[model samples]
Target: MKLKSLFVVAFVVLAPATAAKAFPIVRIDAGQLIGRTLDGVDSFKGVPYAGSAAGPMRWRPPQAVRPWRLPRDAGEVGAMCVQPYSPGDPGVGPLPMSEDCLNLNVWTPSERTEPLPVMVWIHGGGYNNGSGTARLYDGANLSRRGVVLVTLNYRLGRLGFFDHPALAAERPEGEPAGNYGLMDMIAALEWVRDNIAAFGGDPEQVTIFGESAGGVAVTQLMVSPRARGLFSKAIVESGMGRQRGVTLAEAEGETLRSTRARGVAWAQDAGVAQTAAALRAAPAAKLLTPAPSIYGGDLVINDGIIVGHDVVTAFEAGEQAPVPLVIGTNSAEFWWIKPGDDTPYGRFDDDMTPEQIDALAQGFGGREGYDAHVISDVIFNEPARHLARMHAKAGLPTFLYRFDVVSEGSTEPHEGATHASERPYVFDNLYSVRWDYERDQRVAKLMAGYWTEFAKFGDPNGEGRLRWPDLRGEVDQLLEFTSDGPVIRAVPNPERLDLVERLYQKAVREGAVAPPAGEVGTPPQRP
Candidate 1:
């Protein structure tokens, strides 16, 4: 986003105080807010929905936002969640990162009594990094569409999801505190429920939407009983019910084993092993390095708070909220993984061998593994299909789609639609953006229309426009979003998806893959 000048313009001064003071202004907050332009869209940015999770609160559940002494500054952006990233990742640049990054942003058409539909956004960063401050996430365009838009930042990485047995034992009577990150989201929803009316939004008409790991978080909220009635609808893009977390016993055991193997050696070298407090006090930077697979801290099973788990099973059993859902993925979801032949971001090795390919295929679960690397299947296509099936099985209204739009990169069939390639088209912010500015307008209009329409009503199938079919019956009809135009089709390949589902079923049936801690294997506990 273009950085606005730091000097406070006179127009920014909030009303009701004095001429000497300067504060970001919102047009209305007293009466009914009807359809209005950007001039009347009251915006609040960098609002603290939760307390700063720093110092002793780091790696624990979020605390309540304390009362401010002055009119809190909501014009600026908030701190970003901590995560390790170099400049190599596309659309990602080096910026300040921190643990005290639990904040949110809000946009409303007006603070009138119209009670506009609310859409809350959760960002995707593999459960490690992200903020509500990303430029493309700016809610100005959507707010102009007669809806209230909200974007939030949740705790991530070790600060958000580290689980320990000792920590569980320390919980106060009725308060369970594992899955602190998920709780942060629930807390944010609670805050919105109490305060969104001031921004002209109906707390009852809220829709939760997200991408990637954020999508995964949405799935968790859908299945979580504690999260019941928080959101009335959901949108999951490029992420779905794949892996459920493990149990508290499992998570604590894994932490103990992992720390003892890696952290213990460091602790011993530092001459402290009698207590875990010493390890907790170590510099967060030293502990933030990305470790290989299991030992690296990411979302795992936390038995304490995330009870009655396994999101996939929960959905299948009709345990999730029976709300309308739209889920889909990009065609070239994994294409970006291969940046260039010389690039370190792509490929498992400098040279590709049949043996390595065979190993990879086998590791992905035989035939399903072979299908996973096919751009769309892993990131978008398969997950979208899975969500549809689960929702359909439960007899709920579900819409599935495929984003086939491609740029002029001119690779091969594999380069048609990459992961997150559809974002510009979805938000209509492509004009003022960095990538694909000139080419992303129309698609943006169509997607933003679909999303906003879905928010207004429960359906994207509006009359007098492009017809989007609901997910009904056995046939999987997908709304194809491409540069040519939007059309509905019987997706392209079913056999690949069939193979993938068979593999998933095989893995589930035989217990070949363990659910992430605090999940399918463990029973639910009362909070």
Candidate 2:
């Protein structure tokens, strides 16, 4: 069905047209809201999108906001999903942690023409941390680009993603458990579909974009049946699709350990009953503890409900929602290597022999460079290319890119672009991140333009910018952002990607997921 049929946007203007000054009081699907306009942009912060995940709603799909008659305050951001907040975190304010974190923030150009394209940002903190209120994520600058910029928070950690036999048993027969974070994303999109018009947004032209774990979630949304028609375009930065996420149960797939097993074991340690009641009754803090586990942090669970199949599998089988897509990774995401483990060739051990592995190593600049690069290739880089090629082959417009820009105060000796170096520039919030370089502004504008351009039109190409090549007809090229400027170049290492793809396909056929970076085996100490 078309987006027009999907949303019935009826808002009661608090006052008749041409009022002296409206409090910007506009009614939405939920209720009347009052937002403030500043610096040519109107912003509504801490807007409730989903009902509380507290009480009986815990571990279940998000519900609607509890009804309210009065115009609740939309001035400040909502409490962050329960997480440890260090004082040094990005744009973090004094908002306390709570289970009632299903809120979103919207920014709109006060002087824009009617109905703008909406770009909903999903923040990335490895799925364990990050809220929509980070100072760097303030959407004013992007809103100035003539699109509604939305950033939201989803449940995180065990509270966000947990699967247990007991929980499954308690679920209505065939109802999906685990992956509540993904559910929260879908819920937010639904809010946008029905309510974004209140902020002058076009829900029909919505685009979902994210980095790292958020990027991964973007891919999951693309494959989720429930999320299919909610968005029209997608952008994934450093989101890994080739790797397998955990299966809800042993029989689910070949990803990591069954989520059900981990849940049972976690409950047993807490001396809590395996029943859903006992699990839900347990304090939320207990679930937030960070012990080493393969289940959390950018992990996906194939519950056959919310997320039907592996991301790559869905794209390959043509089951994914076909939308204009932009997917890529930074030059060097966080990865490590050690002797003996192939590092996974960092954690994905498979049938490739030493000779074959050596061939792969040479492509990435031989064994030493391979040690540094293979993990990234297997986990982030190659996976991006795989998805782009598949999506393009399906007769959809797909643009692939590599973020090679390095920010100030970067890792010593410059480890290419840090996993998330592009965010500051992507949002055109350089000063917020503490950089004074003039070159960055140009690059930032370029990157931001590419993104907003993609959101406005399904393609990123526009006037006064290098034409971004589409991955439709060819698979060997991509747009790479450099310190000097954005440039399109042949993919860095085709031979390496080829070898990794072959091995990945083999593993998929055999039913196995490569363990996450450092998920298994101790990495050799950083030199």
Candidate 3:
């Protein structure tokens, strides 16, 4: 396949700023010398993409990473932004807390003269937390399969996302930074475009992929004109558009009002004014924590740089990148968000009254109301389906799937495919987890093959793999990844999804969707 080269020259403009070395060791810009440790095949790590987000730059867009006068240590992993996690997942020990956490790692199968395919992975954490350093996200197995794998860390929580009008005013004319995390991803891609060739990766064959919010970010990039030509394909594992719309006015209003309220309350407690300078000078932790709850500072319409519009709006208007896409969700996505033992799909004893059943159903949507089922629908299924539908309607090649396999010895509480469950299988990183290998081993091999196939040829078709279907029609089939083997089946639960589709259409007509539907409209389909 011919690699797209629209922006290859742009990288050349940035190349003079890069080092003149080859694999295992290469220059990123003028200053840094990234180290490498490949298992025979070429793989590199700890390549700085942007300067640190520490101190003053905390909660701001990533700055250019300054090169060290001496060779920087790229061997040890970087600090992961602070986040909450379950007992099984421990925290990164003793890494310094700073806002300057923009960096990327790469892995390749060989150091040969040929430039291999590249896959840049963005980790998922509900717009709040997660790090590229996580064990399950290791790219070793993926690199071994002939693709140069990359994983990166962006600003998270208050440090990566906080925004203020004061900061907006600080912009140089047309540039404003609010979605620092997204900005960090953009900067990383810019670095990749200029530097990947030195790492044995074809800059023209880059595919950006992610899960959950990272997935949402990938789709957002699709709609971002600024991101055009940077990547040739996209893989959004779960984050669809369930919670990704905010106009700059809307976002700014929300931030200003919320920050004022929280700041006033804090001022009353600490006896100080709620002015911008006051807030800025306040103890960083004290000021930052309350800002997110009030203003939702992570992402907002910044007007110029980001176009400060809704993702769905840009996509429907055909402003998004026209790239081959692989998008999908898990079958039992609700299993991951169950609080306590309250699974979304758990059986309810038949002792309930009609009213109770109605209420339960209403909570999910009447039959599928805002209740427990919304957990999966919002985060996984709906978003994935929306991307497929939008791309297919726009005449772009789109592949979809539902991962339905269950690991062997997996208990009922976690019986079906849950969110992020497929990561281990796709990356073939089972060694990082303590799960039973009986069922996982087979599924892992199959899935790893499918993912690598897609990354290699922009299509997940290969010998011994099921013929994956395209997302062209309403009843389009999606590859079902399971232990038995991959099977192309009708998009899962067409009837249920149709019902939800009607709900969205109704909401749109009623103007209930805050981010108004752009030019994109779903033609009425006969049920």
Candidate 4:
């Protein structure tokens, strides 16, 4: 495959007598790209990793970018994939929405003679609404610790994962239908494998990491034969893989008809003909007005090419990529669970009596904490533990964690460590809130140190640091990150995880719930 190249050229302006330091210039497969220096780190942004997915190219697998002659400017972020807008969505970068958003950014140490470990980040917004240029994902802080950090934008929503008979009929020979988003990720990894060395990155030592939906992508990629050998290590944060995937047969007409109908209806509503070409030509804004459901099963499917089987089954069969793993969730991952709403406790038949609520809460310590605990366990925590256990059972070195640090300005009385709260600390970018600056900084340093260390070495623990034992033996242990620092603790509520897993398995057996429908797994959304 012919891929794009990036040639970096750093432009310096100074007096004639003063010799200006040259910036880092690396030649990628596409072309040469010039990256700027920021805080002693060389940064490259808006570098195209694949061809534009606009107009005729939409919904198809990502194509290789046409080689460029001149070095394209790599100083600014590229456009984000078309996605619905949400109020206060911090993950959306300054760039506008476009179909041609298959670009990636890189951050590396300004000076490096030897190839360094690489960490590729996949942003999470429920598979429909995030960009790699999101300020929260700025790789400068992480790169300063001597690793190449990369973040890329992928297809989202219907554009990335829509299935229809017409679409299936149009698929090119040997190309899989659906999962364009995952195909984009695979393409980006292929680009990295062939080109990252020029930027002082060791492609052989790549670590793919992400949180939430991104975490789901990590697990999916791990189980994908197409994604095999693309990454050597994986980190999944709050990603649920217990759900089985719908096979292509299931997605064609069994479970995905409604999703395809939604796409067809949207196309008609937008005044476009119900055809792929017409849909591709439709305005991006029209597509964003009605946000796609995060729970829509079409996003990830067992398409035979990208995902041969459900992740759980693949892992159980030891068919997944054998890579070291670090996976976990926050303590209060599902604080969004509300009273009087359907919950994992088989749902309230009616407005539950206080006594009934209390009874339900008993397994989770009390009513005050019950909803968050149960929901978190079923949706995020337990699934993480299950995946960790699977990796350990397969003899792949596994490290697990539970993030429990409460941010300084949190107003939720019951919030301990909510979803995505650990991101800033992991990136060493604590600009989210101002509560305990010193403590937050310390947490950031500790977390970033652990992550960078993991990228460098398969193990997270290094000399003089807190000892983090790998998950082994009868008793499973997890490193808990708190404001007080890291502490070893037993995986909490093993019985709860077991119960959830059993319930999930029963559902699968009974066909009460369909598995993931595409290459990217979906985190179970609260009903």
lDDT of 2 by residue, 260-279 (tens): 77677778887889988988
lDDT of 3 at 77: 58
Q: lDDT per residue, candidate 1, 357-467, as tens digits? A: 566456446634454453234334665687788897788888888888875533445546766666666667774345453345667778899998988897887765588
**Of the pair 1 and 4, which is ahead by lDDT?**
4
Q: What lDDT does candidate 2 reach at residue 457?
A: 94
Model 1 lDDT at residue 103: 78
TM-score of each: 0.80, 0.88, 0.81, 0.88
Give residue 284's lDDT in candidate 2 (0 to 100): 82
lDDT of 3: 0.64
lDDT of each: 0.64, 0.77, 0.64, 0.76
Model 3: per-residue Cα lDDT over 1-527, one tens digit each:
01222232233334634522322345556454444455655445556788866656655557776656644445445656544331234423444434445767777665466888889999877555677877777788888888888999887654555555555555566565556677888888988898887778899999999986788788778777677788998888866564435555555564332322333454566654545455455554553333231012124343546543466666677667888889899887764443122321222213346775565455354653334454466445765787688888888888999998877755547456877778888888887665657678888888878787888788888997778887765346788887787787877656556555655665567755421222111111112
Cα misplacement distance, residue 308 of candidate 1 (Å): 3.1
What stretches of model 1 exceed 4 Å from their correct place?
A: 1-40, 86-95, 111-113, 254-276, 291-298, 302-304, 336-380, 408-414, 432-439, 514-527
Please give the lDDT score for candidate 4: 0.76
Q: Which 10-residue span in candidate 4 carries the lowest summed lDDT?
A: 1-10
Residue runs of model 4 more than 4 Å from their true location after superposition = 1-22, 86-93, 254-272, 339-362, 365-369, 432-436, 514-527
